[model samples]
Target: MKRVTGIGGIFFKSADPKALGAWYRDHLGLDVTDWGGAIFEWGGADSAKGMTIWSPFKQDTTYMAPSTSSFMLNFRVADLDGLLATLRAEGCNVVGEPQTSEQGKFGWVLDPEGNKVELWEPPAGE
Candidate 1:
């Protein structure tokens, strides 16, 4: 079974999310939105249509709990449930149950280094 296909997003903590976002917007021209992030559309002859998100959370955010790392990597997966099951069978530290929203289906797991990893199955046709 195919595991991770590509990176879905990159998230990190910041002392001042707004300031950091503005810096990216002004200096890096990231088109940071009011939500303090930007979506990068990508399509190549050898790749599937997709987008990558770049965001920064407040330093105190508890989203990456169980991980002391300051960053989280979101991976794009073709089959979230299947891949998660395989990870569990392989003794990976699968986190909470998977969740689905308009955006897509999401699952969490911890890598060997204890970094929180997010697995995402983008909404159909996305």
Candidate 2:
């Protein structure tokens, strides 16, 4: 049998959740419901949402307060340039420039809480 499908939602405790949510909306332009926790609708199974929650614990670090996860969540995107441009225009701290590796074109964006959020544009045939 096949494994799970994809991530559904990521629920983390933010020090200032309101500000964090606003940051996600202002920078990434995600559809933040509750006025702040932005949700990006990923295309997958209708049942996929029920089957998976992408808030998998970071393997590299042991559990502590939810805030210290030690790694950022990554979202695969279609248009990296446009998104990055918009982020820059919004005065966001887009770090280290965009890097292309075997994985794909990747970059990092810092949230209001200073957590690094990674964005990737997958290569062809992915």
Top-lDDT candidate index: 1
Where model 1 places Cα greater than 4 Å from the true spot, the runs are 1-42
**Per-residue lDDT of candidate 2, residues 8-123 (tens digit):** 55767789887777777667767778856656654476523212235656566642223355657777767888888888898887776788989679877777776777888877
Which lDDT tens digits does candidate 1 get at residues 1-126?
Answer: 998766666666567788766644542346888788888767789877766677789999999888889888776777899988877886778998899999899999886557777889999777
Clashes of 1: 0
lDDT score, candidate 2, position 79: 86
- Model 2 scores a C-alpha lDDT of 0.69
Each model's TM-score? 0.65, 0.67
Superposed by TM-score, candidate 2 places the C-alpha of residue 108 at a distance from the truth, in angstroms, of 0.7
Which residue pairs in model 2 clash with each other?
32-38
